[model samples]
Target: MPEATADRTVRIRLVDRTGRQVTDAEVTWDRLIRMRAEEHLPGHTARLAAVSGAGSATRP
Candidate 1:
């Protein structure tokens, strides 16, 4: 990134299945990206499952 764009904050939090505030853990970009991608798979599947084709839009 450019020097001017150095100011950035990636706030992240972890939690269990129950509503509990889990904290104080370390993570990396690769791990975070993979986790996020896996999370979106189910969401995307449900959103586009009823579409007619692969190029269909799930949202208006």
Candidate 2:
């Protein structure tokens, strides 16, 4: 049997105060681009969302 390669597709979502996804960034390296486009990876946007806390009682 032949070995199967894994699919690489990265999904990153950047949400503002209103939970809107703002995905925008630069890729200077080819590896990064490939990884992002074919590795199912998550960049800073995903990281930020993961660390962000829920909205507070007070409004900005």
Candidate 3:
């Protein structure tokens, strides 16, 4: 879940890598959209790399 912040952006709480402290990170609407796509891109790319197609495939 996300909390609405005063900055007009949705804020999500994240724990530090060390797992000691918590922090608030603000994500704008545009960034949230990009983030959603970006989050899946790597997994999609990995799957594509692992799968060899019978036909030719070209990357942009």
Q: Largest TM-score belongs to which candidate? A: 3
User: Tens digit of lDDT per residue, candidate 1, span 1-60?
Assistant: 443333333456866559686754555555556567787566668667656466566544
Residue-wise lDDT of candidate 3 within 1-60, one digit each (tens)?
343532357776655458765756887766665665786577667678678652446643
Please report, in order, the local distance difference test score of every candidate based on alpha carbons: 0.59, 0.51, 0.62
Q: Candidate 3: global Cα-lDDT? A: 0.62
TM-score for candidate 2: 0.23
lDDT of 2 at 59: 32
> What TM-score would each prediction reach against the true structure?
0.34, 0.23, 0.36
Q: Model 1 misses residue 14 by how many Å?
A: 2.2
Candidate maximizing lDDT: 3
Q: How far does residue 55 in candidate 3 sit from its true spot (Å)? A: 12
Candidate 3 displacement at residue 54 in angstroms: 12
Is candidate 1 or 2 superior in TM-score? 1
Give every collision pair in model 1: none
In angstroms, what RMSD does candidate 1 have relative to the true structure? 7.5
Q: Which ten residues in a row are the worst by lDDT in model 1?
A: 1-10
* Runs of candidate 3 exceeding 4 Å displacement: 1-8, 14-23, 44-60
Question: What is candidate 2's local distance difference test score?
Answer: 0.51
